[model samples]
Structure formats: structure tokens, C-alpha cells
Target: MAETSDQDSKTEEPTEKKVRDALEQGNIPVSREAPIFASMAALMVILTFLIGRGVQQITLTLKGLLDDPDGFPLGAPADALNLLTVVGLEALRFLTPLLVIFAVFGLAAQLLQNAPNLVLQRIMPDLSRISPLNGWKRLFGTQGLVEFAKSMFKLASVSAVVAFVLRSSEAKAFEAMYTDPVALPEMILSIAMRIVSAICIATIVLVAIDLAWARFHWRRELRMTKQEIKDEHKQAEGDPLIKARLRSLARDRSRQRMIASAARATLVIANPTHFAIALRYKREENAAPLVVAKGMDVIALKIREVAEQNRIPVIENKALARALYEAVQVDQVIPAEFFRPVAEIIYFLQSKQAPRPEKVQ
Candidate 1:
């Protein structure tokens, strides 16, 4: 009941990370019947392309041996060993090609269905593998039932195909009784081929269905709940609260830098309490007055304090202060629109500081 509820809750499609992890952990689905079909194909190849030549070669060798068994003096155990060795060599020569074909077919089937990789998780020791309760649960589980059903289906299909093929070839089988002994194997091979071909066709259909179901089942198993998706996103992107804290720290550092730089101002324009802009003028530095710092409220107060401590002039101009605070940034020159008003301020300050002209008398 708990498992079913958990599965029901996992309604969201699996994320890319989940699918990738499943593959790395060897959780991919594969159809078992694909290998059986491959073996049947290998058998078909052996019957069609290999068996005739191989059998003829073996038969010629064997016939020569049996026809002249006593042609040479063979009264020793060594002679018997030699005869056995010859027979063994002939058997291997005939069987090696068949074995190689079967191996290649089986490996190709697996390779076509799945990419090969080494996954230690599959081979790791686990007590659950040995526990009887767990084993029993597995035996009666949904996957176990599915496997059982597939086996029953394959058995029934093969049995029916074989029975039908044999029934249709019944007359041929009886006729083989009067046929030459040499031709009996050929007749049997023909009937066997029909049976095998029918079985292969049946299994091909089953394999197709199994492959589709396997992929669907695997993807379903990988689904996540809404909460799980959120958790994964948090893990990748970090918590919102923590990120906000980091941004706040960055802003604080920037404000401190701006306040510390206020001591370099030539003059501070202020709105008495809310706005402040620190300007620096030098003919060699820039064409227009540069805004060294600007801020509002508390930061504006701090800039004013720093300017006063450095003995920099602080003039009250509400409109200019507010306009500079809105339009200018630190280390940037004021815009051309404010050149006339600011140039007048600079001329007034210069006239105030000019030395009195000395009298000639």
C-alpha cells in the first residue's frame, strides 16, 4: 500500500539528471526475448549456409576412416589415441564456425538493445539479495509476474508452431522411412527449419511488445513528485533566502566603497537632508565636472560628513543635488544640460578666492 501511494505521488516526468543517473547505474530496460530471437537467427544461418559443407567434410573423413580401419596395422593403444584425436579435430572444425556465429548473434542482440558499460552498483554485495522475505516479495512482484507471463507466452507460441509444422510435414516424415538413410537428415532439417522460422516470427512480435513496455515501465519508475522537483531545483540553484542574503552583502560592500570615496570630492551639492552629489573639477582630468559620488537619505548624510571632514566645500542646491543624484553615477561626468549652471557655481567660487589687487601707492 505504501509503495502504491509513493508511485501515485510520482506524477511528474523524470528530469534529465534522473534519467542520466539511471543509465549510469545500469537501470536501463532490455527485452530478454531479443537474445532468444538472435539465437534462432544464428540457427537459421547455420542450417542454410554452414551445415551442408561442414557435414560433407566430416562425413568424407569419417567414411574414409571406417572403410579402412584395418588397412594399417593398429595393435597399440597409441593407434587408438591417434584415431580419437583425428575424430576430435574433425568435430571441432565443423563446430567452431557454428559456435562463433551463435556468439556473435547473441552479442549483437544485446549491443543493439543497450549501450555497454561497467556499473559496480550491479555487482555490489547486498543482504537484501539473500533475504528470503525480500526474495519472496521479488518473486511475487509486478516484474516477476510480467516475466512469468512472457515465459508462458513464449512456451505456448513455440509449442503451437512446432506442432503445426510437424503435422503439416507428417507425410514427408513417414516417406523418409523408405527414403535413403543418407537423405533422412535432410528431411528432418527441412521440417526443423519450418518450425524454427515460425517460432522466430512469433518471438519477433513478442520482442517488439516487450521492448516498448520495458521503456515505458523504466520511465514511469523514474518519475518524481512535485516536492522532489523543487528539491532538485534548490540543490542546483541554491536556496532563495541564502541568495538574497548574498545580494544584500554585495550591496553593502558597494555602498561602503562609495562612502569612503567621498573624501576625494572638490565640492558636495546637497538638498540639506535627502540628496547629495560630490563633484570634482580639474581641467586636466575631464572636459566637464565629474560626479565622484552620489546617494540619497542615509548614504547622502555619510557623503556630506566625509566631505566636511576633508574640508571640501558643501553647497546647498536642492534642484541640482536632486537632478545629479537621479542622472549621474560615481566616476562619470555630469551631462551637458547642467554645464551652464555648474560652470556659474565654479566661477563664483573662483572669484571669492581671488587675492585683492594691491594699490600702487
Candidate 2:
């Protein structure tokens, strides 16, 4: 049972590595609609301002037309042509800013969400857009359902507001029309205000619904099962066997390097039979001691070979070597606890001209 568990852990090691790689690369796909909703809310506020500005301009234009129809002459051929041109230009001017503002806001929303670039793939010969089946499906889909609901809600809300406004202002509205011609602007504004308010309220309700739907779908799409995540990692990386082979190759190379490094060490500490660690220290001018070489079994054997070839002294301190190997890594300072013992060993080795007998500490 223990052997089987060990084998299972070994098998999973490569898969774990692959999963970590995938996470670092940001290959994960996530929905962008939450940001879209937040941006739309901002857009709605901007639209309200734009609408008010447009209404003001339209009101002024209408007043000018009413006060002097001949001066702005809609009936004359040249005057009509000029008026049409002006109106067209004004419409463009109004729409351009709104379009630009909406586009910029939409882009910012997408950017915030880290949305991938969209690539258009023409699927099914482009007939799907016009197909009755597709149309029906869309009509029955969440978007279509929302649109239907919005239309009904707007109708109900507007009808209610209009009824209330008309009932409350019936007498005053009539009296203003009769008493003051200049008060036409004020009356027009009051009616416009009621209509705008109803529409704004209806829009707010629709936006809220849209936001809720977006959030629901975003969560649904982004939810990943553990198995699905595992599969995705596999797909993004490679099969487990290939990953395992790569890791095996890496560990072999690391073992080789460790053996070569340990060969250069002046002393090797061994755990008698199970573990071995080699350590080399250099005391250069104005520099602290630096470990030049260090390594376990096959690596320890290779270090021993290199030390024999170079005729470098090799001392075997079973306890100290095992402790150093377990507690300190290569290229790191020996722990404070082991420093004194290591220093004593180094001093003894330096003082001895011959290979010292195994010292039992």
C-alpha cells in the first residue's frame, strides 16, 4: 500500500508541474460581460446628459421655426434645401460624439476584463443570421425574452406615468396654452420632462435586468470542474508521459551537476549509509566563506571520484554531513546552529597534514 501510494505521487508530480505552467501563462478564458454591464451603466448616465442637450437644441430650433417661419422659410425651395442640410449636419454632430463616447467606454470595459481579441469566423455560409430557425431561437433566447419583457414594462410604466401627469396638470396645462404664448416653451419642457422621466425609469429597470442576467451567465460560463481544469492543463501542455519524461531528464541532469559539484568539495558529510553531502568553502580577500561544491548516493560517489582524481582531501563526518545536507541547500549559508561545528571541522582539517582518523564526536 505504501509503495502504491508512493508510485501514485510520482505519477502526479508531472501533472502538477503542467498545471502550474498553465496558470502562469493566463491561457484561461473568462467572460467579459460584468465589465460590460458596469460600463453600460456609465454610458446610460452619459446618454441622459446627451439626450438633455439634444432636446435643448431641438427646442431652440423649433422656437426659431415658430417665431419666424419666413425668416427660416421651410416652404422656399432653397431655404428648404439649406434647412435640410443644416439638420443633417446637426444630427451627425450630435451622433458622432455619442458614438465615439460609447465606443471608447466599451473598449475600456473590454480592456479591464482582459478579453482576448475577437476573430470573425464565417460559419455556415452566413445564412444563419437570416434563417427563420435561427431567428426563432434568438427570439426565444434570453436576449429576446428580456426585450419582450422590457417592451411590456416600458408600456405599463409610461401609461401609468402619463395618466398621472395628465390628470394632475390637465387644468394648468390648458390655462398656460391660452394665457401665455411665450410659456409654450415651459409647457413643452414640462411634458418632455414627464416622458423622459418615464423612459429613464423604464431603461433603469431594463439595465438592472440585463446586469443580473449578465452576472448569472458570466458565473455559469466561468465555472470550471476539477476534471475540466485537469483536461485543459493537459491540452495546453502535453500528455502526462511526455511531461514525466521531461522531468526525469531534468532530475538526471541536476544529479549529474550535483555529483560534479560535490567532487570539488574539501569535505563530505554522510548519514553513514542513506545520505551524503560535500562542502567546499573559499575565503577570498575581503569576502566571506563561499560554498564552491556540494551533493547524495550516486552524486556522492561521483564527488568522491573527483576528489580522488584532484587529490583534494575528503573527510567523512557522518552526523555533520547528514545534518548539513538536510538543513542547508547548495549556494546557501550553513545554518547558525551548524556553523560552529562546521568551522571546527574545517580548522581540524587545515591543521592536519595527513588524512585524520575518523573522529567520533
Candidate 3:
């Protein structure tokens, strides 16, 4: 169980590391609805242009028929068929450009908003697909209120534009009907263009406002509290208890390895209380001394057992051992200050000389 806990701790670090990496990337979340408003604005502009052009064309055709009905031959079946075909084709042509413009603008709006790449999940049906609770919540929500206001604003703006255009053109439009048929179509076309342009401009303003609102709401929804981030990390990885157990098991395994290595040490230096440091050196093979093992209390006892079993020398140096344990870590060279004393110990052992107990002078 301890071994498993140790393994878990080692694995947990990578998961946390990945979360940290993602946070560092600093991706800003966006609302899905913002693009819809932008796209609608683009579509409205296209519709305005197309409708204005179509109305002008239709007005010209009407003027041509009214000015000289015999010359245009509107009564013949073949001529009527050809005229209908031309009008139908012209309407399609007008609408085609608008369709293409809307499609491109919609795509661009989505891209600029940094929406997530299209995924199957968005299109897939789920239990919430038909939820009346969600419907009611949306209908009575802030978004619904915004939509209602937008509708009223559009209605009022269009009504005002129509009233102004009709009042200004009523005299001229009436005079043109009796004076010249061509002038009649021109007047009608002029009125239609003014109305369409007003509607388009109004739509653009509303959509821009809606897009801004959507962005603000999206940011609010994505804001994460510090505690929430922590909880998410824990869920993605595991709890602290499991991580602590794993670390303990790892330390135990490391201690076992250290003890096994200490058996080959030339000497064990002890603080005579808590610390123990074992040093090993090989002349002609190593340029400097190496620490084979280090520990405290129970770990110190374990180091002693390994040294004694291997017939390695043991020395009690309260100050030097503690300093070595504190200043140097395992598999590191002893500090320069302790080098002379440590060298003398090594020299005596290698030369088969008697052990000397000399205090630093």
C-alpha cells in the first residue's frame, strides 16, 4: 500500500504541471451567441443592397411596360413567358450575392470571436434538448429583455423612416403618375431605397450593441474563483492525502537504496545524535570524495547497520557530521573547510595507519 502511495505521488506532479501550463497560455473564453449578432448585421447590409437593386430593376421594367405597352408586347403568351423568366432569374441573381455575402461574414465573425473548432457535441441531441425549464428560464432572463428592447427599437425606427419617406414623396409620387409613367417607377424605387437603407443602418447598430453585451456576459460566466480552480485541479488529479502517502513510500524506497550504497562507504561520520553521513572515495578513479548515504535518527541507525556489516569504519564527529549533513546533500562533495580532515582520514585508512582522534586546531 505504501509502495502504491509512493508511485501515485510521483505521477500526480505531471498532472498539476499540465494544468499550470494551460493557465500560462492564458486563453480568453468567448460567447457563442456574439457571432450570431455579428452575422445578422452582415446579412442585413447584403439584404439592403440586394433589395434596393431589385426594386430599381423592377421599377425600370414597369416603366418600360407602362410607357409603351404595344412595343414591349406584354400580352403575347411567349413574350409573357420570357418576361416572367427574366424577372425570376433577376430576383435569383440579386438574392445570390446577398447569400454569399452573409455566408462569408458569418464565417469571419465566428473566426474573429475565437470560437472553439466545430465539434460534434454541439450538434448532438441530449436530455436538455426539450427541457421546458430551460426555455422558461431563457424567456424570462436578461437576454430575453434585451431581445424585447431590440425588437421595439427596430419597429419604431422602421415606422418613423416609412412615415418620413411617404410624407416627403407623396406630392411628387402623385404628380409623376399622371405626368410620366417612367417617373412613377423612379419615385417608387427612390422610396424603397431610403427605407431599406434606414433598416440596414438600424440593424447594424442593434447587432453591435448585442455583440458587446454577449462578450461581457461571456467573460462573467468564465470567471473562476481561486477555490474553484483548486477544486478543479484536485478533481483532475487526486487529493492531497493520496499524494502524501505516495511521497512517504518514495522516501522509504530512497532510504533503502541509500543504505545499500552506504555498505560500500569508506567511513561513516556521525553527529552522535541525529545525523549520519557516509563518504566513499576511490583514488585514480574519482577526482573528489562522494557522499554514499545520509540520514537522521532511525535512518542514522540503518546507515550504521549497513556500514558495520560491510566492515566500513565509523567515526563520531558531532560538529563535522551535522555540518556535512546540513550543507551537503547525498552524492555531493564535502565542503572545502572539511576537506583536510576528511583527506587525513582517507590517507590513514588507505595506508593501513592507525585511526587518529584529533580535534580541529
For lDDT, candidate 1 versus 2, the one ahead is: 1
Clashes of 3: 2
Cα lDDT for residue 226, model 2?
A: 59
lDDT of 1 by residue, 11-128 (tens): 9999999999899999998888899999999998898889989999999998998899785457999988888888899999999999999999999999999999899999999899
Model 2's alpha-carbon lDDT is: 0.63
TM-score per candidate, chains pooled: 0.90, 0.48, 0.70
lDDT (Cα, tens digit) per residue for candidate 3, span 42-161: 655654556567767766877886897776566779999987787688767667777787788777766776644545555677767579987875777766776677678778977987
Clashing pairs in 2: 263-303, 269-321
Q: Give the per-residue lDDT of model 2 (tens digit) for 1-361.
A: 6734443444222344444444354433333334444455545655456766775786677678678777766666998899888778877866777777777777665565554543334233477799999999789876578668766765787688778777877887779857868667667666666655655555566556656665555444344545655787788788899999999999888777767776566666555444666667777521323344455666666666676676666666777777776787776656678878877877877777546334435
Please identify which of the two predictions, 1 or 3, would achieve the higher TM-score against the true structure: 1
Ranking by lDDT: 1, 3, 2
Worst 10 residues of 1 by lDDT: 352-361
Error of 2 at 40 (Å): 17
Error of 3 at 9 (Å): 34
The model with the greater lDDT, 1 or 3, is: 1
lDDT of each: 0.88, 0.63, 0.71
